[model samples]
Target: MRENLTSVSSLNMAFTDSMKPTDLSADKKGIKRKNWRRRIGFLLKTNSSQPILRLVKNRSYRPSVDDVNQWAQSLDKLLGHKYGKAAFHIFLKSEFCEENIEFWTACEDFKKLTSRKDLVSKANSIHEEFIRSEAAKEINLDFHTKNAIVQSLHAPTPTSFLAAQKKVYSLMENNSYPRFINSDLYKELCAAAKGEGKHIKS
Candidate 1:
């Protein structure tokens, strides 16, 4: 498993090496200049190929008892915790609906853009990747919402995808969240968190 992750990491590096934008720089969050493309691509490849093995391999982001307890409280709480979100993303992948979280995550990052150029470029990218019909990882969006985003791309803003993001969030909250709460992956995480030291919050 470790060997697989290392190979995936290497492949991602090779895939992204020639594609880095010259104008890009690390963000305040210390995210490297590879930005979303590298991550999105790596996630799609890794999740689709090795859902279970990837989870067993990556143990650096161990969850705390409070993290697991908070995750059970709400979808937002779960996403707010880094490890919880990562776990849920894996669960979504295993169910073959990871695009919902992928699109949601892209929008969250999109909202943090301060550069007008970046806002425009990323809005169009998001539209192409997740909004357009037959998009590679398209989410289930209504025509009205999808058209609205298309119309706004020429003058995109930080909130360009706000409506669409909310819709996806609602979809995941209603559908995936319930399943995740009862999933073995989530239960295992809860158990692991408990084993860390303190009793899990009931």
Candidate 2:
């Protein structure tokens, strides 16, 4: 159990509070603060969700209203968006279940390898880190899926981890995804996106 974003309540507060406009504008410090806010606002208003880091331009990233709304619609929509995926990852880390997403992402990356050598190496690494009996970040898997992955590792193919990956994805979708949707972190994000003033820092 690593200390995740939510575990640091103060940092989480700082991130959510970053969305609100600062109460300064009379002195040089105030002027600088306003400029910083403007720059960050500009970045958030961009069409793409590329800048989803909670630390916007150093200390924050605000998802647009659309982004937040779509996340609530389905797990697919949430994971499909880069910002959504990043936010979910942070949420999962807080829950100490980040291995699910991590393994899924590794499987996705593994599928893109063209060379057999690269596939074999990555396959073995992913297995040792995640699929082995006592892996570093072992994920929940049925005995059948686990053994299947072990067997496939010797002559790894792009889909070698497909079943295991699907299982992990299903676990997140059924368990963590719902919790994430109803989490304080998510509520704060929604508030920031919908609130008059918006920003984030962590």
Return the lDDT, model 1, position 127.
89
lDDT of each: 0.68, 0.69
Predict model 2's lDDT versus the native.
0.69
Name the top TM-score candidate. Answer: 2
Q: lDDT by residue for model 1 over 1-202, one digit each (tens)?
A: 1122113445334222332233333552132212322333343332344332253453323456787889999999989876578767766754558789889999999999999899999998998899999998899999999999999999998888999999999999999999889876566566666663222221
User: Where does candidate 2 stray beyond 4 Å?
Assistant: 1-61, 196-202
Which regions of candidate 1 are displaced past 4 Å?
1-61, 196-202
For residue 88, model 2's alpha carbon misses the true position, in angstroms, by 0.5
The C-alpha RMSD of each candidate to the native structure, in angstroms, is 12.9, 10.4
**Candidate achieving the largest lDDT:** 2
Clashing pairs in 1: none
